[model samples]
Target: MPRRSLADLAPGDLVDDVFLVASKQSRADRQGNLYLTLDLRDPTGNISARVWNVTKSLADSFESGDFLKVRAKAQYAQGITQLVVSHLEAVDPARLGLDPAAFLPKAPVSIAVLTSQLRGFLKSLDDPHLKALCDAFLMDDAFLADFTAVPAGVREHHAYQGGLLEHVVAMMTLASTVGELYPEVNRDLLLVGCFLHDVGKVRELSHQRGFDYTDEGQLVGHLSLGVSMVEEKLPLVQRLLGEPFPPETLLRIKHMILSHHGTLEFGSPKLPMTPEAVALHHLDALDSKLHAALREIRDDPDTASRWTRYDPKRNRRLFKGSAPPAAGEGEEDLD
Candidate 1:
C-alpha cells in the first residue's frame, strides 16, 4: 500500500508512512515512566506524535532530521490533530531511494522567480551608496545561496524552503506601494530595510536537516547578527564607491534592522525611531501575521468548525470566512 500523507490524516485513521523527524523529546509521564514526543513531517505538513511507555534506548535511537518509518493511529486532541505512534524506526533515506526534498515543505513561489525579482528590486534603487551596500551582499555567492534557500521562520509564517526570499520580495512590493502613498517617506531606504531586515536569519538558522537555530543564533539572535553583517560590508561599499558611505544612511539602516521587532518586549533592542524604521517594523509584523493566520486557517483539519482551534501564540481562534468563489472558464483554480 502507498504511504498516507500527513496532511490528509483525519481522526480515527490509521497511518503507516515514512516521515522526517522534525524534533523529538523524551519526557517523564505522571508515574515517572519515559515517553517520547515528536514532530513528524512530510512535504504537506507536520503532526505532533506521542509514543507512550517508551524506553530511553528507543527514544535515543533516532535523532531529529532522520527519516523514520512510522506506525500510528491518527487522533485529534487539544484542538489539533496528532498521532499516537505504536512503533517507529529510523531509516536511511538514500538506501530506501527516498528523496529528501519530498519530505520538506517548500515555498509555493519558485526560487528562480523570486531571485529575479530581488535583483530587479536592487537595480531599481536610486541611491548609489545604498545600492552599492545591497550589491555587496548580493555579489557574495555563498551568502546569496543561503539567503535564497533559508526559511523565514521555524513555525510561524513562511516556514518553508525559499521562504526568506518570498517574504523579502513581498515586503518590497508593499514598500513600493506605501512609499507612493506617503510621499515624505524615503522609498529607497525603506526598500533596502525590507530586503535586509531578516537577512541575518540565513546565518541564524540551519536548514540542512529541518529548521533549527545554530549556536550563534541561540546566543546572539538575529538583530545583532544583522547589525554585524551590515558593519562588515561597510568597508567594501566604501571601496566600491571610492568614498565613505554616509554615516546617516548607515545608522538608519542598522537602526531599522535592530528595531524591526518594534518593541523591547518582542526582542527589539530599541523601538523604531525613524520614519523608515517605524514603517519597516509595522510592515514586517503585518506580513508575518497575515501569513501565519492564513496558514492556520488553511491547515485546520476541522472542516466542520467555522473557527480554527485556539492558538496560544496568537491568543485567539481565527474565523474561517466564506468559501472562495469557483473558478471561471479558462481561469486557474486557486484551491
Candidate 2:
C-alpha cells in the first residue's frame, strides 16, 4: 500500500500507518475514565489523537519518542483533525518498513552547507581570544557533529533536524550586516555570541528518534547549560591562545548566552546589559519569531481564509495575502 501523509488525512478516513509519537499523555475524561492523548506525526504535520479507555499496561508500554503502528478513524473537531485510535502498538523500525527521515521535519537548508557557512562566519572573527573560543567549538569533531544535527528547540521555533545550525547561520549573517550599521556594537563579540547562545540545545534536546527534551534539559534548562558549556571550554580556548583568556571578555560572552532570551519570564536569568548582549538578544529574537510565524503560515490548514489560525505563542493571526509583486513582475510605467 502507498504511504499516507498527515496533511491528507480528513474526517471519516481510516488511518493505519506508522507515526512518530511527538507527545503522549494519560488523561481522564468526564467520568474519570483513563484515556491516552497523543500528538502523532509524520514529516508533513501532526495531529491530536486519543485512545479511549486506555489501560495502565498499554500506557506504560510506549513513550513520546517511540514509533507506533496505529489504526484509527479520523474525525474533524475543534477546527482540527483528530484521530480516534482503536488499536495502537509499539513497533520496531525494521518491521514497519518506513524510513525514519520520512517521519520527521527537517531544515530546508542542507547540513553540510550550513556547517560551511557557520565555519566561514567563525573564521571572519579577528579577535584572537574570540577566534580561539570559536575554534574550541567549531574544531571539535564530536561537538560539531552533534551541533549540526540537533534542533534549536523541541518546538515553537526551529524544531527540526539541523535547525540549530540553520538558526545560528541566519543569526550570524544578520549580525554581520546589522553590526556594520551600528559601529558601536562589538561585531566580533556579537557574532561569537550568536554561535554560543544556543549551543547547549545540542544536549538539551534529543533528536535520535524525535525532538523531545532530555532529563538534563528539563532540570537545568538550555540557558544555564549553555553557560556551563562555555565555562567547560574556556580553559581549552586559553590553551589555544597560549595565554590566559581575559576574565572580562569571557564573562561578557557568558552574559550574552545567559541573557539572550531577553526577559526573566522568558528564561533569561539576566537582562541583556551590554551593547553586544542587547544586539544578540534582538537578533536572536527576530530570527526565532520570524521562523515561528512562517511555520504557522505554511502549516495552517485553513486555505479558504485570508489569515492563519490564531497563533497563541505570537498572540495574533498572520495575514495570508499573496506577497506583493517585485519591481519587474507587474508594475506599470509611471509616465
Which residue window of length 10 is worst by lDDT in model 2?
94-103
lDDT of each: 0.91, 0.89
Candidate 2 regions exceeding 4 Å error are 97-101, 322-335
TM-score computed on alpha carbons, candidate 1: 0.92
lDDT of 1 by residue, 11-122 (tens): 9998887889988889998899999899999766789999999988898898888899999999989767899999999998899888887777899989999999999998
Among these predictions, the greatest lDDT belongs to: 1
Off by over 4 Å in 1: 10-13, 78-80, 325-335
Query: lDDT of candidate 2?
Result: 0.89
Q: Model 2, 1-335: lDDT tens per residue? A: 66787788879999988889988889999999899999998767788999999888999999988999999999988677899999999999867577776677788998989988998999988899999998998778888888988888887788988999999999999999988899998899999999999988877888888889889999998888888998899889888999998999989988999999999999999999999999999999899989988888887777667789886766889998975567798767899
Return the TM-score for each candidate structure: 0.92, 0.92
User: Which pairs clash inside model 2?
Assistant: none
